[model samples]
Target: MKITVSNWFKSGSPWVWLNAGAVAVSVVMVLGLLALIAVRGLGHFWPTAIVAADYTIPGNSQVQVMGQIADVEEIPAQRLVDAGLPKPGNKALIDRQLIKVGNRDVSGSDFVWVVKPWLQNVSHPKDAIALERREWGNFYGFLKDVRQNGSVVASGTEAWAALQDSIERAEDIYSQIYKIEKKEIGHINSGLERLRLKERSLELKGTNTPEALADIAASRAVLDAEYKVLEKELGDLYAAFTRDSIQAQTIDNNIVDINVSKIVRAYQPNAMGFFGKVGFYGDKIWEFVSDDPREANTEGGIFPAIFGTVMMVIIMSIIVTPFGVIAAVYLREYAKQGFVTRVIRVAVNNLAGVPSIVYGVFGLGFFVYFLGSHMDQLFFPEALPSPTFGTPGLLWASITLALLTLPVVIVATEEGLSRIPSTVREGSLALGATKAETLWRVVLPMASPAMMTGLILAVARAAGEVAPLMLVGVVKLAPSLPLDGNYPFLHLDQKFMHLGFHIYDVGFQSPNVEAARPLVYATALLLVIVIAVLNLSAVAIRNHLREKYKALEI
Candidate 1:
C-alpha cells in the first residue's frame, strides 16, 4: 500500500515531526549557549603564561611589553590605520592581541592592544612574578629585594622566599585587623547608636531624667573605651602590616616598591606545572564564590550577592504562597461565577504580562514610601529622619517580587482546584464533612503539587529579575549581609547585594572593561545556576506531592 503525502499530512505526522525538530533545535541552542558561557567564564581562573617581548612600530623606538595575553582577535587593517597606527604590509586583515600589563599605578591602564606582527623575541621568564593586589589591579615583574623596616633583608633568589614569609605574616595581621574593624568595632558602633536612640526615645517621651542620663553616659563610656582599645590594636597592626615591602623590576627595568600588605597572592605562572596550575585555578574559583567583591566589582568574590539573592527569594516565597493560595481558593471554590469574578480573573491574568519595572515603581510608591513611612511613624519614631523601614530594602524587594509573581500562583492553584472530580466534593459533603474541613483535609493536600509548580515558576522568574530588585533593594555594593550577628539578626530593612545587579554593574558600569568582561560571564552563569537550584528544589517537592496524591486522582 502506497502512503500518500496528503494522507500523511492529514494524519498529523508532519506536525509532530516539525514540533520534535523544533524542540531539538531549541535544546541544542540552549546547551550551546551554556557551553559557551562556561568556557569563557571558567577559563578566566586558569593562569596563563606571561610573555615578555619587544614591540616596535614603523619609525618608532622598540618598547618592552610584559603581561598575560588576555585576548586575540582579527580585524580589518584599515581600522588600525584609521587609528593612526601604520598598517602591516598589504594584508587586508591583521591579528591584534590584548595584553594585561598590570602595574596600573605606573601605566594608568590595565590593558593595552598591540599588533601581532610587531611583537619580537617573546619569551616567558621563569623568575617573572604575577601579583594580585587589593588595589591598583595586578603587578607583573621580577622580585629584586625583600625589605624589613626599609632595610634590605634579602636580595636575589633569597628575596622570593622572604617575600612569601612576609606575606604570610602580613596576612595574619590583616585577619586580626579585619576582625577588629569589621566585627568588634562595628558591634561597638551599633551599641553606641542604640544608646543614642534610647536617649532620644526617653527625651521624646518626656522621661529624660538624670538617672537615665547617667546610665546612658556610663554605657557610652564603656563603648568608647572598647573602641579606643580596638583603635590602638588596629594602629599596631597597620604599623606591622606596612613594615614588610618588596622591590621588583618591571619589564621596562623600572624599579618599584610594593607593600606586602597590599598583595593578596603572588605566583610565577611560567614556572607552574599542570598540577600547580590546577591548584591555582581551584583557589581562584573558590575566591570568586567566597570572597566579597573589590575593585568596582571587577575583582574578588560575590558571596554577598549570592546570599542576598537567595534570602530575597526565600522571603518572597514565604509571603506569596499563602496569599496566592487563599485568593485562588476563594475564586475557584466560593466566588460566584459572575461578571465581577470574570473581571477579576481577567485582571489577574493581565497583570502577569506587565513589565517588571512597573511593579518596582509601584513597590517604591506603595510599599516603601506610603506603607513604610507610616510604619516608621507608628513604631520607630525614635529612629525618625533615618527612615528605618521607609527605604528600599530587603523586605520591600521581596514583597515586590511576591506581588510580581502572585498571578502565576493564583492561576496554577485555581487550575489544580478545578481539576478535582465533583464526586469527591459530594462524597465529602455526604460524609458530614464541612466545606472548610473538606478543603483543609483533602482539597488543598491534593492540590499542593500544583501550588509547588506555581512556586517553582515564580522562583525561576523572580531570581533572574534585575530591574525590580534594582529599584527596591539591590545595590552595587552592600557592606554587610542582610543577615548578620547583630540584634534582630535578619534586618529586612537593610539594602543588599544581588547577583543580577552584580552582573549588570560588572558588565556595563565597570571602569576596567577588559578585566570585568570575563567576570560578567561568570556572574551570569552563577545567576542561572542559582535559579536552577531554587527551581529544582521546588520541583522535587512538587514531584513528592504529586506522588503522594496519585491514588486520590483515580
Candidate 2:
C-alpha cells in the first residue's frame, strides 16, 4: 500500500489533483466575489419599507424618527458609554441603526445613526411616502395637502390622488422643456457660433464684404427671433411647472411645500405588495440605466457614463484594429527575421509592461498638447486661445488608448501569423500567387480568428482603463454626450464621461460616502457587464471565423 501511494505521487497524479484543486478554489472565489457585488449593487433599487419610530436618547428628550432603514450594526456598549451615552446595564454589545431620513432641506442631513437600545415603538407607516426628487436627494414625509397656485386644491386622502396627477403633468412639461432648451436652443447657439467663425475667417482673408456681412446679419436676426420665441415658451413652462406644490409633514413634524416639478417619483414602500415592489424595482433599474446623474453624482442614473464608455470603446476599436493589424503584418510577414526585428519585438513586449499612467502623461503631452495644438492652429484659428482640438477629448482619448493597446494586438497577430504552416504560403506562391496576394487571400483569412482574439483582449483592457482616460478626456460630469443631434452628429473633440472614472469618482471623491457606496458597486458591476458583453461578441465572431477556416488550415 505504501509502495502504491509512493508510485502515485511519483507519477504526478498528486500534482495534477493539486493543480485542479487550485483552479477550483480560484473559480469559487471569483464567483463568490461576483455574488457579493451583485447582491449589494442590485439590492439598492429595492423599495425598502419606511419606518416611523420614537427614538429615545439617554439624558435627552425622545423624538420621532422616520426613514428607510439603510443599515444596521452592533457596537461595543463601552464605546457608547465613552461617547457620553448612558450605558445599558451589563450589556457588552449595543445595536446601532443607520436611517436614511432624507428631506435634506428640512432635516439638514440625509442620513443619521441612532442607538437601537434607546429606541422604542418602531413601526412601518404605510402613509409615509418616500419622494425621489430631482434636486435634493430624497424626502420621507406624510402627504398632507396638494396646492395649486398658492390655493389648497386637495387635502386628506384626495391629496395623494392630486399629487400623482400633478407629477405626471410636471414630468411631461419637464420633458418638453428639456427638448426645447437642449435641442432647439442648442442648435441656434451652434449656428450663431459658426456664423461668427465664418465672418472672422472672411475678415482674416480681407474679404469681409458688406454683402457677406449683410447675409450673416440676416441669419443672426432669424436665429435671434427664434430664440426669443423659445425663451418665452420656456418661461411659461417653468411657471406652469412651479404652480403646483405638495404640503408634506416631515419626520421632524415640520411642514414644507415641495414643488411638484422637483419630485421625480413618490412611493409608499410599506404599502407596496410583492408585485408592486417588483414593478418599482424594475422602474428604478430603468432610471439608473437611462437617466443622467444628479446631486453631485450621489443620486440619479449614469446614462452618460454608459454611453461614453461604449462609444469610446467603439472609437478605440476602430482606431486600434487597423493600425495594430497593419503593424503586425509588416513586422511578422514583410520584415526580415534579423537582429533589428528582434530588437523591435523586444521593445513591443516591454511596452505591454509599462504603467498605464505613464501612457496618460504621454497622451496628455503629445496627443493633446503637441498634435492638438498644431491641428487647432491650422484648422481652427478662429477659436484660438479658447482651444478647440487643443484640448483633451474623444479623439485624443481614442487615439491614446489605441496606442496603449497596440502592442497586445501586434503580439497576438504575430503569433497567429507564425502559427500558419510555411507550406501554405509556399503552396500559394507555387500556384501562381504573388506573396501579397497569398498573404491577403489565404494567410490573413486563416489568421482572422487570431486577430479577433487580439481585439477581444484589447477591448477587455481598454473598457476598464481609467487612469489614462482621466488625463486624455474623461470628466466627472460631462454636460452632454459626445454623440448628439448637433452638427456632425459625432463630436470627436468633446470631452466625455466614462464608467471606470465614474466608479472612481463616486467611490473616492464623493462628499456623501454612504449614499455613493452602493452607486460605486452598481457602476462597477455595470462596467464588468459591459466589458464581458464586448468580449463575448468578439469571441462569437472569432468562433465563426475559426470554423469557417478550420478545413482550409487543415
Candidate number of the best lDDT: 1
Q: Rate the local accuracy (lDDT) of all candidates.
A: 0.94, 0.92
Candidate 1 lDDT score at position 96:
93
Cα lDDT tens digits, model 2, 80-152, are 7788988876879878999999988887888999988677898998798999998878999899999999899
- Model 1 per-residue lDDT tens digits across residues 171-277: 89989998898889988988998999899999999999999999999999999999999999899989998999989999998999999999999999999999999
The positional error of residue 460 in candidate 1, measured at the CA in angstroms, is 0.8
- Candidate 2 TM-score versus the reference: 0.98
For model 1, the superposed segments whose C-alpha errors exceed 4 Å read 83-85
